[model samples]
Target chain A: MPTKKGTASGGTRRTPATGSRAANQRADAQRNRAKILAGTVTAISRNPDASVADIAAEAGVGRVTLYGHFQNRAELIEAALMDSLERGEDVLSEVPLDGEAAAAFQRLVASSWVLVDQSRALLAAAQKELPAARIRELHENAEARMRGLLLRGQREGAFRVDLPVSWLLTTTHVVMNGASEEVRIGRLDPEDAPRFIDAILLPAFTQKRDR
Target chain B: MPTKKGTASGGTRRTPATGSRAANQRADAQRNRAKILAGTVTAISRNPDASVADIAAEAGVGRVTLYGHFQNRAELIEAALMDSLERGEDVLSEVPLDGEAAAAFQRLVASSWVLVDQSRALLAAAQKELPAARIRELHENAEARMRGLLLRGQREGAFRVDLPVSWLLTTTHVVMNGASEEVRIGRLDPEDAPRFIDAILLPAFTQKRDR
Candidate 1:
């Protein structure tokens, strides 16, 4: 109890009302942000041109409150899109990596495919709102994670080394995004997405080539 | 000369002044439409949000004249995109398909890549303007040509048959589209795009896989 009462952390501090009330407000703000993000995804899913007012209504929050969390439509859309990706990152972080490179790639893609499908509308909204450079900047962390796995696969001689790793990464995105368009347009069944991705990507990555 | 006079053909009609005037006007209209479509492609290439006024100015046509040809902005963009695609179809139609399937795929991609690169901005414009189904409808002829080639590849056992031909077609699109993005962002060199596309897609199409 004595060691926990140090000046560093707010919960352990002496000012009861000040620290606790501030903490409570911060928690409330986080909860509202989460709600707004979820609502934005749903709103955009229903209508890609959903307004900020529409999102606020869907979130059951006032316009002022939504603005407090996000300054403008572009900011709000970017935040919502990033929030979904970060949530996917949590699942990606937990995927077991100690295995055959090909098997591990499959496991990672399986976890990711559903997230990609879920966030597609928001992703489209983000693309409309953000610059291409900004979008690429946001994808850096996700790209790095995949790059590491791909590098390991290449190192193990499990994946083709003739092509650049960057191009391979691009193909993965193309497949996932193309699959989204396929599912969106009813060209591809949603349930087949994960298997379809693995089927195309795994062989493509592991192929032996003369040219 | 008397035998050349016919009711069906315009040039052979007896009303000389009226017929020639209408014929000249039609040629002028065709030239204007061609100029406008080419200008639209260039305008969208410079700015995806190029306005009708901007496009008209680029084509050196009066706004009223531009409107006379295209009903609206959507119609203008669709026509421009379709025009470029039809131009590519000319090159695609000439690709000698009488050879080995893999080699023909390469030749077709080589012919198609630059056209795609050139028209990508207009495609983005079209995506923003038109519904997905409408865009697909416009792509029917292009898709048919590709389908025919890919079907030949699968039938000849030169490309993989395990995956559905439709999914294989999707993979080709994914690869080409992905390469464009790569080139757009300066991630892949423009000079290398054709080869890069060939490398990834040929293997993706031809790879024999366990899974």
Candidate 2:
């Protein structure tokens, strides 16, 4: 059969070209959003009262471009917070959840301190500026994962089942966050965080098996 | 003997009168200072940004009187912080520290939570508006007492001795403060604070004795 005429061939080629161009644009937008988010974390960490204009400048993006990616200041902060939490979750997901529950819990605590120490300033600013409900929303997934691990521990008799998992998870968050604050203020040595966490948190979760 | 009786009797009465008057004045001054400090705590708790005038109004004292007690706003805030810490220390002192380490620790945590919960706003404001050093200074006494108890527990084999007692005490403070923040933000139930503290903290300090 004879090939289609010039106009039909041109239509097929042009369609693929247009689709690739659109995909490239979408990827570029995502990169810019990531850059803006990273810049926001830096700016807010340096100065909790940093303005949108300051953050945009820090990102090396124009105000209009920043606004295009994030509608307003609150939205930008929320995005930055979500980005930080996602990073923490990425770190947390690496710890094996199926092993000896107490050992897994220790690994979780150690990995968590790495993220907590890194995000101290951002966490402080968010806790100060955001509402409790919004902060809790960002933490919901982490809490659920932690609760699941604790429940597994309890079922295996490695952890106490007397206390609610919710309280245990909340206590874990509170202690980790508090330790981060201590490190920030120079009250606790950063290197000692993991040991402190293991020593303090393990006993709280683990039950006396012989008993 | 009767010749000098009149003059000597008058002198004796005048000396006692003067001494009593000075003692009365000093006591009154202390009472007024206490009132102003209490008022400052209330005002700052109600609004972290409260002004000197607002505190004076809260105390039902004139600005002049308030200033007479505390020279300036920073001084007033410092005084208020010290006063709050003193109140907490007073409560802490009531917990018998010489008893079984675990039971005493629980009592300490319980009594401390009462003060922590009551002074949440004041503590938050102090942490925010003051330098870390100043806040740490106010906490020095409490830290000392906590360390003492931890040492006693370690010696008695009631608590883990492998970890530094200082770190353990710091973790205790961190967890308590975090729980207070949770209660303040309505994330954790206030009534559950004692149980949460026991469940989370007791194990952190208690040594794993043979059950």
Candidate 3:
């Protein structure tokens, strides 16, 4: 190997090969970082007070590797929280905001439920670990998206115009959160959550006479 | 004191007087206990990890007095949680369950919101400190009452019959919890919470054409 390296360094071809290996290493590092982030979400969600070693174990990475990726618990938690929110936003983005307001609202609710359910542990951990201000900031994007959709629904006459869009958005958010808890506790069937949510929420947003 | 004891030993009338004084003392103790319980709810709600001294201060009692009433933090938390549930039940009982299903449901929601709003901190604390089974036990009465109301509403054709009563009950519980959070976070106006709850929930439980 030493003799081959000495010869290879003298050739122009070695530089490109070394560069490609470095690129591959960087990609592997990025993939590992993402896996650690996902693992942190699950670990923290299951136990809000989980240790870094616990998270590393859940992530299937070495403790040293996890520490190398995240300098501290706070940094790792922040990353996990952001990761959850971003995934939730991705789910929301898949929903067509401009379609029939009621139908779109239902789609949004159903799709968002999947994200909400997956991130329950993360949400619980964040509430316990993060400050109110930070939690609010993390929630702002989801709130804005909801508010915009609600207002659009109201404007299109799919939702009640008399009620403030903020109220509608707040109600939907709360119901969804509550529903998730119900499902978690075995009070509501997880399979039926979307329908349960729509049955309860669709009426709230739609016109009184239409229901 | 020696003279009084000698005189009391000689007099039959002193026995009744002493008994009355003892009764008064017991009544005063009961009143103080109630105050402490109420105060603990407020203190714990404001700060989930509130200390015994902090709760005693909120209750306007001495730390020693608080300890005399509740031997430890766990006992005090149990009492606070029970007190909240009892108060909520009282509110539910006041709303006549036999009246028109929709009207009764609205009254139940309005009355329950007041209790729910007041106990947010206690609920949060309970979730963190108490076991899931204990939390379920504490919530049973409220759940039963809501289930009854939903069933009654569906029977009367006041609400959509297609949805299960359990689903309806779960939805109502979650929405109320969510609404409480919204109020807690200052996103929804506290003074308007009951009305807002009614506006959103009435439709969910009631038939669309009926509205």
**Residue-by-residue lDDT tens digits, candidate 3, B1-211:** 0111122222335577796676666666777788788888888877878998999999888988888889988788888899879877877777777778888888888888888887888887777666657887888988888888888888888998877887677667777776787787778888878887787778787765633
Residue pairs whose backbone atoms clash in candidate 1? none
All DockQ scores: 0.51, 0.49, 0.56
How many backbone collisions does model 2 have? 0
TM-score of each: 0.83, 0.72, 0.77
TM-score of 1: 0.83
Misplaced by over 4 Å in model 1 are A1-31, A64-68, A207-211, B1-28, B207-211
Error of 1 at A40 (Å): 1.0
Better of 2 and 3 by lDDT: 2
Docking class of 3: medium
Docking class of 2: medium
Interface RMSD of every candidate? 1.6, 1.7, 1.7
Ten contiguous residues minimizing lDDT sum, candidate 2 chain A: A1-10
Residue range B1-211, candidate 2, lDDT tens digits: 0111111123234577676666666666676777788888889888877898999998877999888888888888888888778878877877888879888888778888888888888887776566667888888988788788889989989998877786787778877887787787777899988888887887777776653
Candidate structures ordered by DockQ, highest first: 3, 1, 2
Which candidate wins on DockQ? Answer: 3
Could you give the TM-score of chain B for each candidate, in order? 0.86, 0.79, 0.75
**How should the candidates be ordered by TM-score, best one leading?**
1, 3, 2
